[model samples]
Target chain A: MCLGIPGKIQSIRDDAGLVMGVIDFGGVQRDVCLQYVADEVQVGDYVIVHVGFAITRVDEDEARRTFEVLKEMSQLDELEWMAEAAEQGMRGLEKPA
Target chain B: MKYLSEYRDADIAKRLIGRIKTRATRCWTLMEVCGGQTHTIVRQGLDELLEGSVEMIHGPGCPVCVTPLEQIDKALLIAAKPNVIFTSFGDMLRVPGSDCDLQQVRARGGSVKVVYSPLDALALAQKHPDKEVVFFAVGFETTAPANAMAVFRARQLGVQNFSVLVSHVTVPPAITAILEAPDNRVQGFLAAGHVCAVMGYTEYEPIAAKYKVPIIVTGFEPVDILEGISLAVNQLEERRHEVENQYVRSVRRSGTEPARALVQQVFELANRQWRGIGEIPMSGLRLRDEFAAYDAERKFGVGGLKVTEPAACRAGDVLTGRIKPPQCAAFGTLCTPERPLGAPMVSTEGACSAYYNLAKYRTADPAGAAP
Candidate 1:
């Protein structure tokens, strides 16, 4: 299971002895069973849900840190690098044997 | 804690998108072979981010969408029995079978329940000892383990009232069928991560080599889909055809061994018919002879219930990626989700349902409505 999708917990309910909650992933909301990881969760906190179950809680600070790194990496233009590498290879081939 | 939150960070996703845009040289057509991935792609508007350079085609990964009309009819038949309590996933309730569905059966005073897991159905049988509980087990390899576990538990508990109407299908065979088709145009594949997690990526290696297509095991998320596409596009650009694992955090080369062994104990490969795709040899699963007592088809003696799909529904074309949802003549006018004329419009994982939910707004414009 891909423990993805950081959904904010809206509310909690006990349905037939099973801990359940309504989780919001942006605008879409779905009912998720929280019995699997109920001991580690709380309201207003974001948790990683997978296959209708909340698997683990995510630290917002950690998420923001990772996003910043990703943004920096995205700025690198691969096409320009590839073109430069190709031109260097062509010059080397022309000068040598 | 999981790799999930890091992978789905929007800032990172935009960065990945920018990286992909810079790397792209030519247009590429990639197909996410799992219906779950299709839903994830649409839900997050991943297509909008890719623009017109990347084409995402839907594949036949939806079990409910591809399950034959006749099998559903047979399930409806079993559910209508006076002492039977039919259990199924909620998505199967509205899938049209001949003239009726599980929802229709419930409306007609039949005992039918929507259960999240087959174990729940087994528990229902245990609690209601007087009634016969037959689970309408329908899914791909991802769901086979849980269903198989339920069967094993039923045998151990000697719960005679419990059984399963298994409609399980395998992934490799479907991929082979799609690649072999004369009209197939899938240049790359985003293999279902969960299916690979259960059955491993070994089966896909041969298919990828034979078809000369890149098969990347992908998770269902916005960034996961983009990363999968980027990987596939890289392979295509480099002319390297191989099976890659983008969801390596969960999937492995051998997959879940215990789960596979459990499935082997309860089920066997058999030639079965798909709704729109016709019959694919040895693609479906059937209960083993020893576990035949828990096979609802044998218990009920309802053979030869095979029925053809409706003439107006082009669900087969939709499943094969030969046509989009709007390409079907009956898509919007006659086959809304509330009044589905076919399985694709009904199941949540279905391509048609995804398009209906996300792309319907875009399709409102006359120029964009042409599929």
Candidate 2:
């Protein structure tokens, strides 16, 4: 039941009786239930989302720094780079001219 | 550092994907033996980023998906009891039994509550001392400790009204069953890291060696899944089948001793039936004879109830890795999240649910073609 993912808060929308927030992880964006932590969080913050609910917030600077280390650790081989380039090419083609 | 965000970095994920593509020798079939990993892989599109040479298959790690129809029927029986407050994780509410689901029971005026923790059910029992509170405990070893703890807590607190309808299963036995299956397609396994975090990796070493397949204990993150796949692919390419620990940060060779001790004290291994896979010996946990007072099925006389599964549901084949959700006759047609034909299509951690929510679009794609 643990469906937690680290996502950066893109924006928050306040509506009647509910708060909606858009969170982005990599390129996948999801509308997270911010009702749980609406009072404390802000745009540009990072949080752990579980089952569409934002369970807790994570430090944005610390999260970015950790990603940096993971990025370095991932560079342990070259086939990874080739796959990334190919994926990037696909993404480039998908973009509107 | 949260230590969680670092594990999910897309840049790091890309790096791992790059390494996997470079190191591939032949087409390797790696099965992530947990439905949590399946959801993560699909939701993040990690499989789309992997090298075409590596194929990631979903395993039967979903406890709800693998839970037999008889058990769900038993749960419904307990829920139907007057003044009985049947509490379960939200995922179990929609899982269809022989005839109906807990949701249907709720509609019929049964007191069915969805709790985030078993402790909450314990609290409900404390609050309503006059009524009986039965918690439908489900999941693999990952959830066994907590469920066992709830039982122990009830006993300690002298909450006579509280009992657990224990449906806890183990991972190793299921893995062994799958490997022994005649139509087994899994070449290697990404063992559920959370399960190993509780039960440890000691039991898996023998299975890996005996089956001659690599078992990597992996976390539920895109990068973790990629790393697990990379490790498994490397082992398969080199013909070295061994138990590897990619989730070393949380799981140890010897798991939490205190948790295991509590579980052992409360529950005993029993040959239980899986939804689609029939009976596998010593695959499930039941209340020990000593703890029979805390067993809801025995206390309520719901043990002997016989129930039949839906005729068209192919959840058993899907659970054993013999077929994917799309292969099921009812999948995407008669069965869906709203009207699941089986438990797999209903549970959040189910492979069918994972496919339904994340990969149903692929049904229209060319078969065996990469996105």
Candidate 3:
């Protein structure tokens, strides 16, 4: 089972000589390794995190195109609804910090 | 959720279905080569939507389901050993070995733990220097990079206690195996997107050309799968056999070179046995001789132990998309998730598990009725 989730890199740093980062999975944040994507990833760049490692950098244009295709198919309403909820969830998470 | 939420749009799924219906000239049987794709298809009722227009079959891509029975038995033996901390993903703990599962071993006083990553297992080795830490590495090319990095890190740190019981597999071989089958009904394939992300679609070109089947690298979301199906249908109608990328957002023609390099550096190709499906030459990744110390099989001496699958289970047929999960006499009766007769019933990504979890009503009465 190849279980990978998209996460945005919140911060990047070296942890004991290994490149690591704090990634935000929507609202939740966790530590991820940048060993595989060290050259391509930036602080704000999105990545596909699989098994604690950032396997590849998520292309901005491709991600936008996917959403745009869905939008063209008249499917943004549900995504809009979810985005609001996710934003709220992120706010809720931020309140603690 | 950023790259994920938009792919599950219901309206997009409907539109994709409409496109697939328009493109379909005749019935085309398409097989999705990933258990993750199967789960999404069942959960989202995509097959029901494309009913009569196209036939979607599940492939032998569930790593846990296809992992050889003897390998599980070896993992069990190692897990049961004293002063050994066994680590694996949550799914593998429930998968049955020859006689018992890792959960049973844990219940009987074994230190089997579920870890999110092989890196976590590496951390376990660092923290527990006195004990042996063995990560049951089970997955395909999608996971090889991560597992390879873990072993690489272990060697770099000189972590003598760390080792991995590898059962790594690749996707193209499995596709070839399916296409080579005598009764193979798959005209086109929806390749696993993540595997393509790591290994790219280059390898698929030859397979598609050789088999005269369209191989579309697809993602796991609802809309993504629908689009993938639509692409396959278009190919079938046009009589085209080529590798297309429906998940261009993540996949490329060449794939992630660094990850592939890491995997190639740490592992060498080997003949691997697929449970129910038997062995396929050069289908699996094994630790190189240079990294032999990090190999748990060699470290624990459990590579020779072997076992046979139960006679009643027809997971072989189910895995190859020859039949649905409920077609087996033991399905839902003798092979429920709680007491699984096969690995397909155990892993969450498994086709049998997906059918049972999302569409168990199909099992209530098996009168040969189509779902």
Q: Per-residue lDDT for B1-371 in model 3, tens only? A: 11223343656766878889887878889999888788777765678778889999999888889988898899999999999999887778888877899989999999887776688788878888999999989899988988999999999888999999999989999899888888888899999998988888899999999999999999877778988999888888888999999988788899999899999999999999998898988999999999999989889998787787877989988988878997999988888988998899987778888788655644554442232
True contact recovery of candidate 2: 0.03
lDDT on C-alpha atoms for all candidate structures: 0.75, 0.74, 0.81
Assign candidate 3 its CAPRI class. acceptable
Clashing pairs counted in every model: 0, 5, 0
Give the poorly placed runs of model 2, Cα more than 4 Å off.
A2-97, B1-8, B359-371
Best by TM-score: 3
Predicted candidate 2, C-alpha RMSD = 12.0
Which of 2 and 3 is ahead in TM-score?
A: 3
Residue B21, model 2, lDDT: 89
lDDT of 1 by residue, B44-85 (tens): 667667766578889988878988887899999999999999
Q: Which candidate has the highest DockQ of all?
A: 3
DockQ of each model vs. true complex: 0.03, 0.04, 0.25
TM-score on alpha carbons, each prediction: 0.78, 0.77, 0.88
